[model samples]
Target: MGRSPCCDKVGLKKGPWTPEEDQKLLAYIEEHGHGSWRALPAKAGLERCGKSCRLRWTNYLRPDIKRGKFSMQEEQTIIQLHALLGNRWSAIATHLPKRTDNEIKNYWNTHLKKRLDKMGIDPVTHKPKNDAILSNEGHSKSASNLSHMAQWESARLEAEARLVRESKLRTSHSSSPSLQHSLIGTSASSSSSSAPVLPSSTRYLDHAWNNGSSTSTVATRMSDLESPTSTLSENNVPPIMTSVIEFVGSSERGMVKEEGEREWNKGFQESTTHLGEYKDGMENSMPFTSSLHELTVTMATTWGSSTTSAHAHGHVSEDGFTNLLLNSNSDHRSLSSEGGGDSNNNCHGNSSDGGNGTGNELYEDNKIYWNNILNLMNCSSPSDSPMF
Candidate 1:
């Protein structure tokens, strides 16, 4: 004979548990502690099946259950657990005392996961989406120096992709001084409208580990057209690709506070007419500069889940970009004279798909394609950043 179902009888209740059912389950558990969930509902006089009773009790009826918004602490824990457990929500739920497996699963699908995407973090690989496309050549010893540089370039490409998507939508309307002001006005308004939406603060990532023992910062060397002395609501579509690389160390944080912070804040404050005025070489020469080495990034569109495919591979059809020639024949160099390497001076980034796509359509297509690059440098990026 076939094995009996857990709830073989018909008309067992399911779906959202009712308050009276919740009360019955709670009262029964309190009076005669539920030793076996499979037999609890019938003994407790509940119409719900064993499965539904177990779910209701574990997910909602429990006295200690914590509901409402998940705290950042809880979010971090869930992310770390999910990374280890994969889709084993029940196993993952063990660590979260008050949260049920279903609640955790829902949060992962609906909330925490989306935040990771917006920051260009791959929820699965726990790295940047661009890292997987790397070939053996991109990981060679000589070419490793360019890895972090490649990450920043990839992020810039993704950011530019956002601009491209937004600009196309903003077309047909002219960008005037007053109009630009108005665009900036309702930035925090709602999700329904497009342009004037501020770029995410993932522009720089500073990851501090073990109580400031070591710090890694990845700063995107924004192109002249992409800087804060600009406005994005303009009708013009900026170049699809540009590259600049910078590494910030912990020691330099004080320097930035004293010197660079002022200039950084000034650029955002001094918004001007960006009528294609940001010439290509405005930040010295293309592909490399005196202060920072430029890596010319070339991108290709992979099969993706984005809303727009018009320029999924970007306007540039070429596979390789010149002048990004990173012929690093030298061995690994250190920032300090001592044996210690400059953790801060290294480019900090990750490889993988973003986690925070949500209802937005450009979730998968937004990944940066580094035609041939691997993770040569370990940029321990801690948090996503915007210009702020």
Candidate 2:
């Protein structure tokens, strides 16, 4: 079959939209959403084609669209994301909430591109002009790593976009007109102009590390934007999300994977602050695959029984998953391994527990196991990231 045109262009307005046109488009969308962008113009009483109406609304009239100059942080993010993503503007736009892909494309063409040229940097490769002289092996290795990370990020963004698209569809059908208007209004006003408010699907991704919505030290559950009473949540639409681990005091202390497991376990046991308790409310937060969910349950049970000392010392670590994995009494096994029968030996084989040779081997194995899990969570898995 041949491709279809976005909209019939005949006899439709093509010039810049006036204030009245913008108001009409915004009001209609705020009330009914731009449900079927191909049909929005006729319903909204605009003379423009649906394609024009969609572009107008998304690029300019949308309440959440941030207007005017980009900040330094945003510029750095754009440059970094561009270096990784090349010219995939929509993918880059996912990282930069509220900023349109069109705006980013334009800004790059006009400003950032010139700035890089002046500095003798190749905008395409995001490298210095003389980078050709650098060692091929080093450059290739770095490029390979960057490409891998970019692929991982790109796949994740696509998944999030798909889930959000589905959620929006369900929301459009279920939400009342009055509720939709209030949601866009609250979303527009409540967010401090500096902070980005993630769309509903972002709850599937790690909010702090990926989205960075909140500035407060305490990492809270999906904000008012995810509240059931909010516009998006009208009619009891379950948060069509599965991830979003909260990272409290994440910036204050860096997570060092190389640290001895026993040492870190001690620190976790001694810490007074308790955070990320998985309660009934969190039943829907993770919604892991059935196998992984069962594994989590097993791990959590083992950790609970063994953490009597942790309770005596005070509170535990920041998150339930962290606490479980960090303090599990059973021997650590790779996630690929199903049953725990063979790997019953503790990874934290203390010097006194097994003397020198065996203890060192177990210790090394423990580090590798932790590294593998951490890398898997942060890189391989799309649904979760290490939250600490």
Candidate 3:
């Protein structure tokens, strides 16, 4: 016989949870302690499906459920973990102390995903959408840079492992006097005598062990270099290793710079397209720069100070930033340039509409632009390329 439905189909409440229904479910679970969700509704005298009861309790009414907004730290953790683990919401919830997988999934769908979309980032891949543009400009640069970094980290890890193995071997050999004597050639004639002759293998092993130790030290220094909190104390990281990390950081910065430039250009093109089709009344009334700048400043200030701001401004800024980039100046190039170059200049100058009817069209096109960018960036290598 097949398994039955979780609860009887007749006369059960379905949609939103009512107070009386919540009381019945909560009272039943509180007293009886909820053994099996599939069997709970019938036993509890609740007119709801067991699955509904379970979802209601788990997602909404659970005593430990954190009902408010997620903090900035939580948002960052979610983003980073999502980048690493994809849509395994249940798995992601494990790292989060008081959150449910369902809640996380909903938040990502309603909030985080939209935010990433607006920011020209691929929600799935967590990479800049302009990767193709960067690549087309003959920048195999970031890939090579990341590859070299991975090599250095790999080498360091390997060297540390080798050192540990050699240390174990030496400790074992030294612990057994018979083996030590045989290996070192310590004779009875040298009883009270000086140093024993070390075997060639033993000498080589000692040298290997020392080299491994040195390599581990270099690796630690590299790690410190990569960390933002690291400071130059009286005892700084070794100069040679610092140089290596600096080189890697420089390459990574170049890649970021290239990606930023492409994003700014894409934003500008999108804005221009909108400006062209803008209606006379709308264009005249459009306080483009002031409105977007106020939005951006408000969002930045809000998010910079509060945990709940993550949920509030998360999606808003992505859309706002893109729009701001668009309606701003034509000369707003080189987003990652030092000393607040064209970006600041554009931000200050491009506050008024250029009397074009493109604003509404630009807003409509924003969604499509982000979707296309996301699709392109999320493509898994060349064989699955969307454009091709």
Candidate 4:
């Protein structure tokens, strides 16, 4: 099939918009409305092509556009959404209420992209050079870990989808009495009562995970195990272990029991000093034991037994899990790998435990990671450069 021309070859202006053209277009749009762009230029007495007029109004002339510099928060949101959505500028723009896709695309290309490059990050992958260096430190070990994590994530997602479908099917069948009657009453009742309702939108996962919504409970549990630590050490010890210990010690009796005793003594002295008010208040006070018990239970569920921990971590098929983790490591390696001949050069630098130069490389890699995060956090202003 032949493609159509963007605009007619007749006498129509096609460069930057002039003030006169803007005024005529704006006045015409305000009074008569822009019902059709192709017909708009002639109706408004402008020489410009309809496309040019439309682009001018939508990008530059729109009253709702925020013309000033972008804020830090706005920049961060853009970076994060961009990471997830890639170069879908229009989609990203929709999330930023007062921004246009053209403006965002320009800013990312000129400003944010350059900044990330200077910081030693791949603007496209959002990763550092050392990732490849570390990956090459050990072939089999890193690959295995990468594969395991991937399979785990895949299995978890599959389980979640299955649960959702099952819930939906049960809900549909329950709502239809003839369908339910085809089955035994006991079976129908159990299915209807057990099936949970899912939210209307997939984006609702954010609120669901944070607030412990029914639909998100399984996913949230998995997330807690897989992502318990914000920062993993080079030694491979989970950060959540320390957090759990601190929480246990603090809530139960303070890390040092002496501190707890001292606080109790101080409270007693204060009560004696204000005897009249203290007696009334003290009568209604409950023991802190119950709160401590709840905390202990939560901690146990979060990190204690191996079986529950595995369940909470969610399942991953061996092959998919291996592929996921390997891909992450591959992403790192691909960025660091210089050429076909450089494989030996890359492998000789570090060890898997990072005991050699691997730790230093990982630390450097982490620095680049943080820098990208910071840049993303501060990337709000629209760039003056042309969009890709």
lDDT of candidate model 4 versus the reference: 0.39
Q: Could you tell me every candidate's TM-score relative to the true structure? A: 0.36, 0.50, 0.36, 0.40
Model 4 quality (TM-score): 0.40
Evaluated against the true structure, the overall lDDT of model 2 is 0.45
Q: Rank the candidates by lDDT, best first.
A: 2, 3, 4, 1
Give per-model CA RMSD: 23.1, 16.2, 23.7, 21.7
- Report every candidate's CA lDDT: 0.35, 0.45, 0.41, 0.39
In lDDT terms, which candidate is top?
A: 2
Candidate 2: list runs displaced more than 4 Å: 135-138, 141-145, 181-388
Predicted structure 1: lDDT: 0.35
> For model 3, how does the per-residue alpha-carbon lDDT over 76-141 read when each residue is reduced to its tens digit?
445644653467565455445357778888888898788767866678755455433323211232
Steric clash count of candidate 1 = 20
Give the Å error, residue 351, model 3. 44
- Tens-place lDDT digits, model 1, residues 11-117: 88667777787888877777666656788888999887787777676677765566776654456556644543356565445344456678999989887677657
Cα lDDT over the full model 3: 0.41
